[model samples]
Target chain A: MDTLRLASHGLSKHDQEILSKQLKMLRGRTACEWVLVDDYRSADVTLVQGQPPSDMPGIIALASTKAGKSGRYHLIEWPIRLFGLIDLLMAIELEWPARAATPLPTLSLAHRLARIRQDQWLDVAGMVAQAFQAKDEFRTTVSSFDELIERLASIDGASVRFVEGHHPLADQEAALEPYSLKAVIWSLALREEAIKSRQWHISQQQFGIATWPLFGTWETAPWMLRLAALYGRQPATLADGVELTGLRVELVAAFLHACELCELGLTVKQSTRPPRIESKLPAPESLLARLRRKLGLGYKRT
Target chain B: MISKILFIGPMGAGKTTAITAVSDSEPITTEADNLDRAQSDKATTTVALDYGEIYLDEDSSVLLYGMPGQDRFDFMWPILAEGALGAVLLLDHSHPDAVAQLDHFLEAFAALVSCGALVVGVGRVQNSQDIGVYQAHLKAKGLALPVYATDVRHKQNVLLLIETLIANAELNEILER
Candidate 1:
């Protein structure tokens, strides 16, 4: 069977190895067999760590920011997972036949947005609103609370209100008031009482998902980011999260607490029992034995 | 008396390097060509364990054992950890899942960790924030283990981890008595 050729750009040796291994695992599962090629020109797809070359064909951009998107140029966020990458490649392959002609625009919106100074909020908001309206998916990519509110306000016939003490425009329409994304995230975490009283309410799901703005953002702490990513994929208890994400039970509980405050986490029944740690005894002549002998103790292997 | 100290972490966290750095004599390493290159970029990895030793005085010495960092060899962890005086949990701050790796090793060596016999040495930290993340993680667990930004390639840093683990073991003994 003919295989799909893939070439990598700017990825570390480790990342390339991971991609290769994941691709090999994906061979029998999917009809498309992905093979890594050193030559970019002959490859069917080019996976890049940062920006892809202008001349590159069938680009798969790996980055944290939502800078480039097209029918052909797909973006997978950094800290790439094996499953996520495979899903993206399969999507691109499926869409290739239909999107072959238009090929997505190469403009780096993330790069352009990053250059906007703090003082350029209004101007940047206008540009962001335009981009968001032009591409519905852009609504999910808003970086800040201000940008999110701005994008929401630009939508015709949308009603947005901030609850009591949550925003400066408490109990007032969001169209009339300005709020930062940081304040919103902070209020959601710290001011649970206010949030429970309906601190903020939007009439419509502007970004498809109810909490799309909160999915991947700088405001999310590292542990929270890991937890959110894992839970966002599926419903899991705190213990499940600890086991899955390799975070401590206490740390996972803290994240769960924050998610509960924000009403972001789903309530699932958790196992009451602590995770069991299996113990295996080392060989008698191993280092453990040597240490026990030196300490004037007999080996008591467990 | 010889006290055993175990070094544990994920792949590429520098267990072998840390052991080699402080060993008084040549370190004994059991390395093989890494078949799971996807887990690490290194051409070779410790399949069994890396062993080294250092003398504290004429009568007492410390045996350092570095466990294979991959999950597949996790069965060797409890074995190596048996009769251990304490542990040095090395972390590669540059790894994509550094925080998760920290939690995994901590859970794997919970016996040593709960007794305050674990010292975390985080290597390749980009900034102080990386150290802070680890510190916060331990703090959240109610653990007061000493955490230091270290480079296992350097003898001084490796010694710091060893000394910290030894100190914790001594302190635990005193408190228990």
Candidate 2:
């Protein structure tokens, strides 16, 4: 087995040696090589960084992955480290076939869309489709209303609309129009089976939003006009589809919201509940702790 | 605020361990080792919910509840999970039939998932081979939930597990706005 190390701004000679020594046991004592992908281009290095890089800000380094044959790369940052280990074990089990590529491009594209767009109420379906077309890691799925609003806010020129009096979100929700044409497009792109059956069609078209826009705007659009745009709309079904990479459904929504905020000049107000603490019963000693006591064995509480 | 929770899994999947891990006091468990009708393998299984509590911040308390892992006790799930804010689905990766165990619990309880519940999967598979196999199996179930290889032997590990689930749950709630 081979190992690699990646650093923030490329790896130093010292960092390379450190990773090699740390992973010396990766391949038993058999023949192994340590390659340093200084530019962070190698797919074989485990890219670990404390916090995120200053340039990348909120974006964390994608997990390490092996080099693959097919262009069908599937790099991922599994929420659990065990999964990453699983990837390695699976590779070994499969005799080290083409590596699973990380979906870094898609993630980068998502972040770029999020940080660079400005739109007022962008179309969810269109944005998701575009994301998939670009081979990003965000798949179109049933999303929370708040996610849509936040993503829109992240993009430029995009804004969410709330039902004039019925909106429940604070500043973000109060500003959105109840009926949106874009929501219909979104519903069509996702949940194809449901759309084909015409199950979520009405709700899809009649969807209302309340959230901040990607950009701010004071102009109020007429409800009747917005409703007209929503009228005569049929359920959205999956016509053509593209697969996303290894990101969570919620993450996709957040990335999309970020993109919308950047692309559209939409702004919104939101109402949120203060974090409430839930009360409960008392705690119990762990079975392990109990067993140690019963056995009269000293166990230090670390 | 009582943060309601539910535990769902097959018999002997460690739901009690999870509840007991974070509970502030001794967990109230209904162990059914004496019931003649109980499955021989599940003789010492938890029959009803395991109730306990833990505090995070001054204003919030996380109420812990565990559900019976047996189908015979399925009738009590609704009552046990009446106001549950989320759920923890235990996966006995060490079991000979891991997939079968998951199907027994999750396949039939789609309602729990639909109610905006945050279900975290705890897989106890130790062997690397078993871990990979179980990972693929979990993916096949479309659980889409985060899974971790956990051991309840350490309090710190247990705390980290709970925190991870809580963070994810909070992230969903925040995004749901």
Candidate 3:
């Protein structure tokens, strides 16, 4: 009969492991019970041991009060804390716009949250990769997450609504209202900082695996949110300058391809040549006489 | 309005001569003038790119950009190929690597295919037998793209190649619908 106060931010991997060990050792005693809650203020769990002094028959004698002074109690003989952590993650994900509307209380919340975070990270990296590959579009690629977020907010049909009440995020949301038009600007700036510190190529690979066949796999509802996360990475060039040697052909080809994709026109400058002069002789006499006289003169084909 | 046309081909494919024959103005030589110009330290083969122009109309000019024959200069290809309305891929009948080079370029620029860019094969075939081989090789790759056999030096033959490009573009525009 020990009580522990846990924060809502919830378990790390080590914390889940510790709870599993505690659950198995305290089983088969009406003494064995646990509590679950959305927050500390909401619930508590209570387990009273040595009620009837027996493992099975005596275990049935203890009275359990989950609602009063129990601190959100629960009972388990297996490692279920991991599952709880997963549920927490799922809740966060579901609450966030990126995940679907349904809140995830059944699935392991931690796993889902980790997966979602990883996916967004990779997405940012992948967009950067695409920017470099499609150099023609690099000029317009959004590098910072803040910029990306702002861009999303400015998206043609985007709309934002405020839900009032004593909500956890209410203050944060209210504070952000003045900068709504500047939207995600701070987030984008933070994302840019994150990208500068990351290994972009490796990040790109991770991103590719995270979001395979990105063209059509994404849902329309989460499209803006996902894009906002992806644009988190700031713009960075993979190849600063290619060697002028052996890569000339490839470089030239790439340059030309970029120009073509960007619709750039070539500037052609034509050179003018000097005019030529013809040496002249005496004039012809008459129609017949002129021909005869011109023919008679020592004239060579010019 | 200037319409750029790129001439792409394998080594010794008469790309240079073709430009000389069709150009309205004196061709600006980009081919290497000195041995040192080539990084290879060999005097044998080195050239940057070839440039020429053909007038489509009094207002519209079609610039002919000739890519160097060697695979070594393939770097400059995309730069030269930019904004090209169509490409004339010249293949030397005698060259053993002609088919491979053709495959390389087509695969490399797959995006261009979707953009309605015309790729016309200009083969130097001495007889009908050679033409059959060229057509067969192209068909084997599932490329039913337009292919022509003509002497690059002949003015009328080059004109035919240009017409083939225009026709191919029109056909694609219709097919897209």
Interface C-alpha RMSD after superposing true interface residues, each candidate, one decimal = 17.2, 18.4, 27.6
lDDT of residue B141 for candidate 3: 58
TM-score of chain A of 2: 0.18
Model 2 chain B lowest lDDT segment of ten: B166-175
For residues B56-170, what per-residue lDDT tens digits would candidate 2 score against the true structure? 4455566777787666778877666665655677777666766776566565566655532434344565433344354455445544333445555555445544443343343
lDDT per residue (tens digit) for residues B1-177 in model 1: 676788888888899998888777799999999889878899899988899886645766788898888898898888878779888888888888888988888889888876766777888875444566776676566554556678888876776565444434433443344
Query: What's the TM-score of candidate 1 when only chain A is evaluated?
Result: 0.34
Model 1 RMSD vs true structure: 19.3
Deviation of model 1 at B17, angstroms: 0.9
DockQ of each: 0.03, 0.02, 0.02
Best by TM-score: 1
**Which residue runs does candidate 3 get wrong by more than 4 Å?**
A1-302, B33-46, B56-59, B113-124, B174-177
> What are the per-residue Cα lDDT tens digits for candidate 3 across B1-177?
666777777655767777788787787756554454322232333276678876544665668788776666777777766767677777776666667766777865555544435444455555333454554665465443445566788875565555445433433333344
Q: Each model's TM-score? A: 0.38, 0.37, 0.34
| Pick by lDDT: 2 or 3, better one | 2
- Candidate 1 lDDT at A85 equals 62
Chain B TM-score in each of the candidates: 0.93, 0.78, 0.80
- Candidate 3 has a TM-score of 0.34
